[model samples]
Each structure stands twice: as structure tokens, then as C-alpha cells.
Target chain A: MPDRSHTRPPRAADLGAFAPIALAALVLALVPLWAGDSRSMMTVVTTGLTFASYAVAFNLIFGATGQLFLCVGALAGIGGFGSVIISDRLGLPFLVTMPMAALLSGLFGAALSWVAVRRSLDTIFTGIVTLAFALSFQSFVLGRPELTGGENGLQVAGGADTLLRQPVEPYYVFLGLLVVFLVVYRVIQRSHVGWAFRALRDDDAAASLAGIDVARYRILAGWIGSMMLGLTGALFAHYRGFVGDTTYAFGSVDVRVLVMLAFGGIGTLLGPVLGAAVFTVMDELLVDQAQVRELIYGVITVILFLSFRQGAVPALTNAVRRLVGADQPPPREASSADTGIG
Target chain B: MVAVLIDGLVLGLQFGMLGVGLTLVYGLGGVVNLAHGQMAVVAAMVAARLMDRGTATALAVAAGILSVVALGVVIDRTLMQPVYRERSEHRVLLGLLLMLGVGFIIDGVLEWRYPIEALSLRITGGPVEVFGVAIRRGSIVASAVIGVVGLALILFFRYTTFGRATRSVIEDEEGARLCGINPGAVRTVIFGLSGGLAGIVAMTQAMTSPVVSTAGVGLTIFALIVAVVGGLGSTSGAFLAGIILGLVNTLSAFYIGTFVSSIILLLAAASTILLRPEGLLRRA
Candidate 1:
């Protein structure tokens, strides 16, 4: 049965729901003032912003479209590694290489989604296929000695540092990107494209019957998400000044992203941002112990899935909304921000 | 040619041991169990630690299997229960994420104790000539052990009442419920059985190459691909797919580079999924 609850567009100009999130981001933005030129804090905040970008980009496909593409890490790797090649070996400008990296990753994502949609593969199957793609990327990087520098990884050139030297500059760069993308996320959510994605996510057959080209929109989702990931990777590569197989490949980066999204909330805009900030802060506090880091993440992942399915941010948001009386947002409107694929 | 076939067959048998549990768990629960590989690693750790301390190999193997079975049941009851209760489209997603977390924890825990190095169980002899084909004793012994166990499992599924009940649930949960079968209990039994299979696979790994804590993902990927390609719910299909993949892997490695083989195998899996999602052998 078609859900009447989601039949209409959500009330526009109702931006009050986003007030809490804007406050949170504003608080995060003040870390620069809080640190007062501390390089470590600046660096940690920069990392937070970068991963927040990653998680948000991931949410576009995973959260909005309900596609579980595990190869986001690999897509990011392509951007990171591509930057190494373009900036260091090719010595291209940042503008040129950044877009190039984004294009490469975006195209790969599109191709993967095309394959999935064209064949009408299940979401689980899509995950499995992308996982293979992820493994393939790691294997490729690990096997290539000269191009990739093998396990030790390739060092990126100081091309980006010329534009932004201090930790503050790169930190702001990432923060700026996060702010811009958050706006972009809102735009995408309210657009016709967003409705199509949510439709397919809810029911592909129904979406198809309703005259939506499910394959085309799914590919578009993949393209948008991966392009953002690639852009994030390119910036991160320059920001970090290095790109390695271990840092960005299969299990490491993807696992962190998955855990963050799962914990913070899969469908919410603030969820990934909140998750990124929290995990990033936790990461800085426990920098040396990889074991402890994984244990905590694992424990959180299980706990969130078990007891907190709506994720922390959404659950919190819903509670507050409930307290304020019956101005409950339409299911479709609040869905992209609250309901996960589950 | 004969040697290649022999090598592939034995390796395939071992792969089958690795994959059966993953397939069963996925089939019964609609949960991917991302920690599937770690279960085997836990078994290997137990066996390797016991044998390293001078315990008899057979006794250590039995202990390892039992330990894994117990752990599997615990995980299913505690971690998997809620995931199964969820009725959302992303219920599998929740399970996958949870299992991924569990995998990370297991990896971290294993590395904390095992030093991130390879741990092995050695067979006492070198290559032996079997019907004019030179084969390593380790492969032969590993294959024999896993094959016997596989056959026993097959027998159990075909003839046992519990196995029949499990199959009924897998085939038609509503009908099975109507017939008075408790799906939850059957699921728990399958979890135990799957864990035992993981233990067997670990022992196979022990008899062959040493497995490291970090190699858990590698094991999981291999098992998942085999299960996916074989047909999601069919044990026999997974077994056949394992042999086919093993043979193809060996042939590709011989013809191309070792890394090429993995890429090729992965591509093959992708093509299989896109082209025949129900699997090459599975009935739609």
C-alpha cells in the first residue's frame, strides 16, 4: 500500500528543525578560537572536518538511496592516490588534480551503480560487489611497487602547502567544505531528485510504477556521493601530506565510516557530522592504541544496532520534537534526516 | 594437468569448509555475519595455542571446535537476536554493521594476544606421491579431515530431524511455524553448527599455511565470494562453487600472476552477481 504519510512534499521554510545542528556546527567551528594556534587541536579538527565530509558524502548514497556501497574507501583512495600522481609526478595544479580525482571516483561510482541498477541487483549483492571492488583496489595498490610505493605508500608533494601552510589554513579549508556541503545536502534533500531517491529507497517497484527511472537516479546518487568522496580524499591527501594503502584501503577507512554513520544515524544530516566529531575527538585522545580504538568502535556499533536503531542524533531530535507538540514533520521530509535504510 | 587438478581439489575442499557456515548463517538469518572469518580465526587461535603448549593435536582440535561452538551460540543469542527482530529493509544493514564491529573487536583482541603474526599447525611430513601426482601432506590431510566432516554434515542435513526442521524453516518460515517448528531454536542450532564448521576450516588452515589475525578479512572475503557465487542458501551449491573457484584460482595463478588471480576471481564473482544473482546453479 502506498503510504499516505509521505504522499506530499514536506513544508518548506520550516528550517527550525535544523537549528540544533547549526548550533552544533557553530560550536565545532569555534575550536579554532578555543585552540588559539595549537597545531594539534587544529590538526584534529581538520581531520574531523575531512571525515565529516566523507561520512556526509557516504550518506547521500547509503542514507538517502539505501545502497550499501562498501567501496567508498576505495573511491577515496583513488582520489588520494590520484592526487599523489597528479601533484607529485605530474606536478599539476590543485584545481586540475582535485577535479580529476573527483571525476575518476565519481565515474567509478556511476559505473558500479549502473551495473547494479541495470541488473536490478539487491542491496546486499551491491554491497558484496563493491566489497570485491574494494579488495581489488587494495590488492592493486599493494602489488604496484613503483607507482604506489607499495605498503610504505606514496608521499604527496607540497603543492597544497604553498596555498595553505599553517594547520589553521587547511583546517578552515575542510571546515569550509563541510559547511558548503551541508547546504548542498539540504538542497539535494529538498529537490525533485531527493524525492526520487527516497521513493526508490522505500520501494523500488512502487517507485518504478510511479514513473521514476530508478536506474538513472540511483546512478546519479552514486555519482554525487563518490564525487564528494573523491573531493574529500583529494583535500585530505593534500591536508595530510601523504597517501598510503593502509590509511585509506578496504578495512581501515570504510570500517570507520560505517561505524560513524551507523552510530550517529544513517539518514540524518547531523548524525554523520556528530559521529565524525565524536569519533575524531576520541581518536585524538587514544592515538597510539589501535586495539583500543577498534574495541570501542566495535562495541558502539553493536550497541547502536541493538538498542539505538534510530541513531543518537535522530533519536535526540525526535525526542525534542515530541516534547514541542504535534508539529511533526512529514515522514518524507524528516525521513532523509532521521530514518535509516533499516 | 593432473597435479593442478589435485591441488585445486584439495584446496577447494578446504575452501568449502570455510564457506559452509557462512552460507548457512546467511541463508537462515538473512544476516551476513561479517565476523564470520573471525570465528575461524578464534578457532585457529585456540588450536594453535593448545598445540604450541604441547597438547595433543586431536584433543586441541576438539577443544577449539567446542570453544567456537559455545562462542557462536553466545553471539547469536546476544548480538543477533535484536537484528533478527528488526523488520526494516535495512535489517541486513544493521546485522552487517554489527558484525563488522564484532569483526573489528575480534581482530583487535586477537592482535593484542597474538602479535599480529602467523600461527600454524604443521603436518609431520613432506610431499607424498599419490597415484603419480606429487601432493603436500598438509593439503592431503587438511582435505581429508574437512571432506569427512563435510560428508558427515551432509548426512546430518539429509537424515536428521533437526536438520530437516532447519531446512523447512529455511524453505518456508511461515509454513514451518504452522507445522510447529520454532525458527528461533533452529536458528540457534544452525549457529552452533556453523561455528563448528568455522572451527574445522581453522584446523584446515592450521594444517596448511599459518593464519594471522589480520587475515580474517581475507578469509571472510573468500568465503563470502564462494557462498555468493554458489547460490546463497544451497550448501551443495557452495561446495561446488568452492571447487570451481579453487580450480579457477589455481589455473589463473599458474597462467598469470598471483595477484591477477585474485582480481580475476573477484571480477568473476561480480559478473556472476550481475548476470545470475540467483547463482549459476540456484533455481529462481
Candidate 2:
């Protein structure tokens, strides 16, 4: 890692960058106050938090950098299944297995990024390759019924004695994880890593010309982002006390995260959190219309991609900014503004 | 071994056919239609519904293919218009995401309305002997259909002026425009052609096995693998890669296990990316 301290954002801007994350964390911390009594509501909120973390991680890899990994579910599944298998088969503790699982997932992600970078695959080719990996991972899981329990899923018996299974406890745990993810994201944004990310994302050749190691930064993003996914996945498995096909299936996890990240602003700090919250509420409201739920989601995805390619958050911010009579655009944070292909 | 090889060849032809639609779209527009398989399923469902209503099979199939062609045109006109406005990487990303959403919509609609509907065409005939091996009549007929279509595509692209114009657009859109070619019109025609091809593949697939409503994603994956391996835009390359992957698929399934074949195929595609990003056949 090259010393990039000189490239760090100004202290005021760094602090300003974290303002939204802090606000989001503060608001989300209050979710359990009213919903604590209802087990179902707690589960719903916790699930939302998990998705928010996944979206944040995705934002780092895709929104920050330009690596469009289509295997979000698979990376998370590695964490979920890795921890479960380690704890169950090896009799390891949850604490030991969780980090181990995350590290393993991170390494897998790094390998993937290395391949993409070495091949110089563009966004769509990277997506295709990662999607292939994701599908293969699903097949591997499904094929190895003796190991994975296949469609029946596996029970996390190791965490059965812990408070993780408690309705409200898991919500707080996931909320804390989300906070960690947000803080990590903001810190990265203020550091030289963030500079490299933006530079490479805009134009890798230019970034390389400017002495930024594009491959190193890209692989670093992949590793860190995948670690977040793996950690959250492991935590969720333990919290829910089960891991199944649906838990990390591409449709259930990856698609939802993509929609969420896109719905929020792709590269915005609070986009994932806002998107996850809105979609979670929408999910709850459409619970009665199960058949049409996915259809509605599909329609919304299409409409959202077509109409607000940048997302609702940035659009809303722009509207508010114009209303307040600001002539110049807001200070460029980690944003998708003018994300034209170089 | 010969029997397995023959079976693989049959499967490979279908895979090649599937790849053609996806590869053509990508070559022409730099858009990988994630809904390619969904379009096929939609066509299958249409044909199935018509057949269920006592319509003749030939007429039902024609309607099914035609409906998808119309869908492709509509999508090119409406959904893809915005995608086309974006350039380079953004265009690819937007197109992919939008098509993915379309795929989900198609899947949701098909699953909701026709949960149990499936298309399985039964071509009744005795097993045909080839190289001292008996092959199913359905497989033989399906292979024949694919072969004919493949030949037709080759001829059309090689000799037709429209085909040359289409290739020119894929090669250099701006240059093609300078030469008086309407890239949008060409894309529309190819998209419709791709849709028709997808419908035909679905029909052929049904002759051997049922094409269920839920088969969209799997089919999409297969098409993608074939397209990527064959080289995104090369028609002949698709057939070549398809046969290779199809053999690998069948052989692995036979020798290793049924579950390992897909993984192997995917690994093959991933390695192809590593070794040859342009695919197996470089466009001449």
C-alpha cells in the first residue's frame, strides 16, 4: 500500500462525509424501541439491516470501484456455510469460525478480482464471469446434500445456547454491524484508498498513469467488500439459527441488494441504508400479495433503472439543494455524478 | 462413448442455437440480454397455452414465435432506447440490469399464471440408426432443425446486404452511420430475429424434454456460457464452442457426476475469459 496520507480529504470534509452515516445509524438504533415486543417485526427489521450491510459492501465494490460482481449471494453464502460447517464439524466456537469464514470469503473474492483485473474484463464480462461462479456455487451447495443439507438447509446448533436467537438481540447485532460497515465505508472514502477507487473507477488507465496501482486497489476493494458480506452472512445464519438455499440464493439476496443499491444512490453514503429501509417496508406491505410481490419488484426495478438511473436519494438531494438556492453543486463526496465512461 | 458423444453433439447444437440470439444482440448492441432465456420460456408458454386450447401445433408454434419477435421489437423500441443512449460501460451495465429486471418480470408472470404449464413436443418415430448407434427420433429431428437454421443464418449473413449492414454496425457503429446504415433499425431487426431464434430453440428443446416455466434462468445461464465461450458476436464460433462445451458437459456428467457438469462448464467459461477474452473464435 502506497502512502497516500497527503491525498486524504480535508478534516472538515472527512467529518462531513460521516455525517449522513452517523445520522442513519442514530435513526436505525431506535428501531427496536417500539418493535422489540413483536418477534416478527424484529426479524423484519434485522433482515433489513442485513441487506443494508450487503448493499453497503456492494456499493464499495461496484459503486466506488467499477467491478460489477454478480455473485453477492455466493460470497455471503461462503461466509454463512463456511462458519456453519466449521463450527458444526470442527466443534469450533462461533467467534473463531466467523472470522475464519469471512477471511476465506475475502480470499475467494480477491482471487476473482485478480482474474478480472488480469484479463482486463469490462463491467459486463466481469458480471458474466461472476454470475457463472455464483451459479456454480449454488450447484455445488445443492449437489452436496450430505454436507450442505441441500434444499432442506442446515441448523446452526452452535448458536442455540446464545442470546443471538432472541428477537431483539439479533436486531441490535445487525444494527451494530451496519454501523461498522458504514464507518468503514466513510473512513475508506476519506483515505487514499477512496481516491484510488474514484480515480480507477473513472478511468483506470489514467489512474495507473497517475501512479495508482489499479489492480491492487481493485483487488483490495473486492477483498474488503467480500469480507463485509461474509461477516454479515455468518452473523445472520447464527442469528436466524438456520441457513438454507433461500438465505443466500441469487434471487433472494443478490437481486434484492442490486435493486436496493440502485434504488438508493449507487455511490452515495446513505443510499444503501435508505434503499434497504424503503424496500424492507415495501416488502412488509406486499406480504399479503405474495404472488405479485416479485412482479412489482421487477416492475419497480425496470422503472427505477429507466427513470432514475442515478437513484432517488441523489435526485432528492439535488431538489432540496435547488430549493435552498445553492448555485454550485454540493462538495463532491463519493457520488455517481457524471459517471461517464472514459 | 460414441453414443455419449452423439448425445453431446445433439445437445451442443441446441446450445449453439441458444448462443446465437444472445451473441448477436451483444455483438450488435453490446447488450447481453439476461432475459434471453425468459423470452424463450415466454414463447414456450404461449405455444403451450395455445396447444392447451386445442389449437393446431404448427399454428400455435408460429404464433408463439411471432409474439416473441414482436416482444423483441417492442423491447428494442422502448426499454432498449434508453440503454442505447448510454455509451460504453454504462450502456452495458444499464442493458444488463434492465434485461435482468425483465427476466424477473417474465419469471414472476409465468410462475404466477401458469405454475404447472410446460411444453413437451412428442415426435413419434422409431429410433434412427447412426454409426451403429440408435438415436431417439426426437433428438434427430431437433438436430436437423438446428442444422437447417444454422445453415440459413450462415447464408443470410454471408450474402445478404442487410446482413452486411448489420455486421458493419457491430464493427463500427459511427462508421456504419457514415455509410448510411441506420444502426437502430438494424438492432431492431436483429433483436426480433434473436427472439424468433429463441422461440425456435425452445420448440426444439421441447421435442426432447419439457421446457417448464421455471427453466428460464437455467437456459439463460447456458446461453451466456455459450455466447461468452464462442466469442460474443461470432455465429460459427458459437456452434463450435457449444459442441465443445456440450461434449465436456456430457462427458463430465457421465464420468464424474451429474452435478459436476454445470460447474465444469462454468469453469470452462471462466478460464476462457482468462485465456481468451475475445472468445474462441475472433471475428474475422
Candidate 3:
């Protein structure tokens, strides 16, 4: 079995990757000032930020853990419902509803992880299971029309007004959440738990033999990832001022989530954000040509996958590292603790 | 109650036919051929076109099945063959993308040819009163055909040398290769056969209900759900699960409304995974 315990400090190569993300964020932040259109700029920034957060959360399981979960959209949809229900039905404050929504989603993720871990299934089976979960949740929400607003969807009265009332407010709120999630993610990535996650992701049996408690780490990743997704979903619902069954529909937004994660570079902290930005911009530009957009999207995805298997971010980082006269950091050393276990 | 049960059986049989085709491709090739549903749609549309041209029902069905088999060969040779050698997780993902692309292309061609509304032909036949429940003769015919075909498939798999070769390849490709079995040839034949089966099922379904371009996407999703619930690689499991899902869907639609029925089906599939991750039937 391969070593599963070697840990490395954040290298100079890591800083090069972080530089691009920081620059992009700075540019996005200064966009309103340059464009002199506060409203549209705010919308773009907030939308991009929220989607980035969702993508990042999605990547935790998909990119980092190498688990192909198809329910990110539904999880976010659930989070949206959670926030909307708390705020609209129970009349809780947005601040209160947000954390509660995230918590519920995290718990939901944990439960899913528990099932996934216990089953000892392969990735494809896990994917199918999650896809089923997404469909089920969508159905449950739509069936209980009183809760999810069914097909017509539930409108949060004055919901958009509450946030859009102040353009800067929405932007700042999104920025704050994005920052918090990113910080938490970065810190987690540097921790032992994060290393455990990587180990399990690379090889579960080997990780288990290395005393990584594979299931526990997987569950933790799911919990954290889902919490972030839930939070983003709540913000999106509030921003859009509605929550509907269609919002969580699989094969629609679900495909988009996968596209975003892949486009941005799965597994990297900054990949999702970049992917989301590019996707949003492309979507906006292509919205006029509605008939051919899907075809184009499919073509691009296939080409990208065929050409750059590591995804765009990792591929680009590798190229940049090569250009900058930097030694490609040695592959992270796997812990050599377990030998002859079989 | 009797009506619901009969309806459930009819729908279940239909699902069983589709599920069987799906299991063949998945079990033999490890390729989730998302294109399975599209093949069914193509068959249905071809049959519809033949019927429009005043062809006999039997001839139309035969042509439809033949066309589907031809398309399956095309697919296997072009899109699927390139990726067959490397059976990685990424290949499965790529298969999904390829199917999605192919589905879109099919949809585009279909939209150009057929109108948006669903097209159907009512078989002029009297209803049969069974146990005090009046049911369409068409439903009875569909059930009988499905049962016969399903039984034939079971027999073929159990008794035929081709079936043994197919099973050997499915169990262990390398071992099969060592035993001098050509995996590629086996896969191509199975894919073509499965596509033919899908075509027949699609034609029968369109005859029973209506044919529409968008119906292809819905059928694909339904087939996928059915296949997953039945277990990806288990034929008997798919058959049983299809019947179960068909009953659940029909009864739920009757009692809970159409939209809710779909939701219920989705939820049931999800719950099944939660309960039995390997599926109800574990194929050896």
C-alpha cells in the first residue's frame, strides 16, 4: 500500500496559485467603481460570489474527496427552503435563518455521508444514490406544496427588496459570506482532518489502514461542504426572492453545478470561483442565442474534458509554475505508516 | 383496486422491457448508455413515420427495430469504441457527456422533423371487462408482448452459448480475454442487441401512448431511475424493480396527481438506495 501520512507545508508554489484568485477578486470588487453602474455591477458581483461559494462547497466532495455527488443543487435548494421557511413562516431574522439553514443542510449532508460510508459502494453507485436523493428531495418539496410552493414556487414577499434595497448591502453580504467560507475551507485544508480527507480520497482502504478513520473524514467533509452549500442556497433564495421545486430540479441546475465545478478546476480553493465567473459571463453572453447554448456548452465541456483531464485550474497552475522557473512541488508524500497490511 | 392493480401490471411490464435493455448495456459494458432512452424515441418515431406512410404495423415495428440496431452499431463503432479500452471512472463520466451530446443532437433533428405536440394513433379495439374492470385491449396486448419478450430474454441468457460468453466478459474482462473471448466483439453485439430491444420497447410505448420529441428526455430519465433502482447490472433486479416502480408510479398518479406521482417515484428511488445501496438484487 502507498504511504498515506506525509504532510507538507504550504509551498511558494501554492502562493502563485493564490495570487491569481486574489487579483481576480480585487478586480471584481473594483468593478462597480469603474463601470459607474452600481445596480448591475452589484448584481454581477453578488451573483458571482454566491455561485462561487456554492461551487467551492460542491468541490469539497467532488474535487477534494473525489466523490461524485449529484445532489449539490438539491442540497442548495433545501438550504433555500430552510432559510425561506424560517424567515417567512416562522418570521425569523435573515441572520438567524442563514445559520440555521446551513446547520440543517450540514446535518443532512452528514446523514447522507453516513449512508454512503456504511454501504461501502463504489463511486458510480454513490453517484447514483445521490442522484436519487436529489430527485427524492425535489419530489418531497414539490409534494408538500405548503412547504416548497410546488410548481408555482413560493415567493418571499419583499425578499429581494430587503436585500436589493441597498445595492452595496447585497454585495458586502455576499462578500462576507464568501470570505468566511473560503477562510474556513483554507484552514480546514491545512489541518490533519483535511489531510485525512485527501488520503481517503486517493485510496480509502489504504487510508483506513493508516488509521485515518476513512468514514469519519468523509462524513466530516460532507458535513462541512453541505453546510457551505446550504448557506449559499439560503443567500440565493433570499436574493432571488423565491423558492420553488424547479429550483432544485436535477438534470437542469444539477448539470450546471457539475459544469461549474469542472470548469473552475475541481479540488482547488480558487478553481470554483474562477469557473463560476467564467460560466456566468459566458451564460450572459450566450443568453441571446438560447437555441444553441446547450449544444455549445456540451461541445465545450467535452473538448475540455478530453484535452485537459486535470481540469482548467490545475492545468493552468501547472503551466504557470513551469513558466515561473519553479520546481513543480514533489507530489505530496503519502504517509508510510502502513506496510504489508494485506 | 383491481383497476389500479391491472394498470400497475401493464405499466410495470412496460418499465420491465425498458429496464431489461438498460441492464444489458450496463451489465455487459459498464457503460451507462444514457443514450438508451434516445434510442427508444428514435424507434418510436421511425414506427410513427412508417405508420404515417401507410405501412403495416408489423413491418413498421420491424423496420424500427432494425434502424435502432443500425444506430447502435454506429454508436458503438464511433463514440463508444474509442473509450472502451480504458474502463476508468472518467470513461463513465465521458460516456454520460457523450450521451448527453448525442441526445441533444437527436433532439435537434427530431424538432426539425416532428411537431412539438405528441402524436398518437388509437388502435380501434373494444375494451375487455376483466373482473368487473374495463381495460383497453391495447394494454393487454402490450403486457402479453412484454412478458413473452422478457421470458425469451431470460431463456436466451440462460441457455445460449452467446449468453455464457457475454457473462464471462462481464465478470472479468481480462479473464475472458485469456480464455480467447473477444470482449470488443461481444460488447458490440450486446450493444446492438440492447439497442434493438430498446427500439421495440419504444415503438410499443408510442403505440400505447403518444410520441413526442421531448418525450425522449423524459423516457431517458425514467429508464435511468428504473435501471438504478433495479440495480445497474442485474437483469432480474431491473425487471422486478421496473414492475415495482411502474405500479408505484401509476397508483401514485391516480391518487396523488400526476406531478406528485413523478415526485413519489423519485423519492422511492432515493429511498431504495438509502436502504439497499447494492440494490435489492446483488448480481454475482
lDDT of each: 0.78, 0.85, 0.72
Q: Score the docking of each candidate (DockQ).
A: 0.58, 0.52, 0.39
Ranking by TM-score: 2, 1, 3
Interface RMSD of 1: 2.7
User: Against the true structure, candidate 1 has what lDDT?
Assistant: 0.78
Q: What tens digits encode model 3's per-residue C-alpha lDDT throughout B1-284?
A: 78888888887877877877877787776777776777888887887788878998788878888998989888777777645754566567656656666776666566656746453646678988988889887778777778888888888887898888888887888899999999888888888888887887776665578867667777777778778888777777888988999999999999878767877787788778767766679743
Name the weakest run of 10 consecutive residues (lDDT summed) in model 2 chain B: B275-284
Residue pairs whose backbone atoms clash in candidate 1: none
lDDT tens digits, residue span A218-328, model 1 = 999999899999989888887777778886777767878877776566666666776676677667767887657777667656655565444334444443344324432
- Segments of candidate 1 deviating more than 4 angstroms: A1-9, A12-24, A158-160, A309-342, B1-4, B116-119
Can you list the residue pairs that collide in candidate 2? none
Off by over 4 Å in 2: A1-14, A309-342
lDDT of 2: 0.85
Q: What TM-score would you give candidate 1 relative to the actual structure?
A: 0.91
TM-score, candidate 2, first chain: 0.89
lDDT rank order:
2, 1, 3
lDDT of 3 by residue, A56-134 (tens): 7887877767677788888888788888888988877877888898899999888878788887767776787787778
Q: What does chain B score (TM) in every candidate? A: 0.95, 0.98, 0.94
The 10-residue segment of model 2 chain A with minimum total lDDT is: A333-342
Candidate 2: Cα lDDT at A242: 93
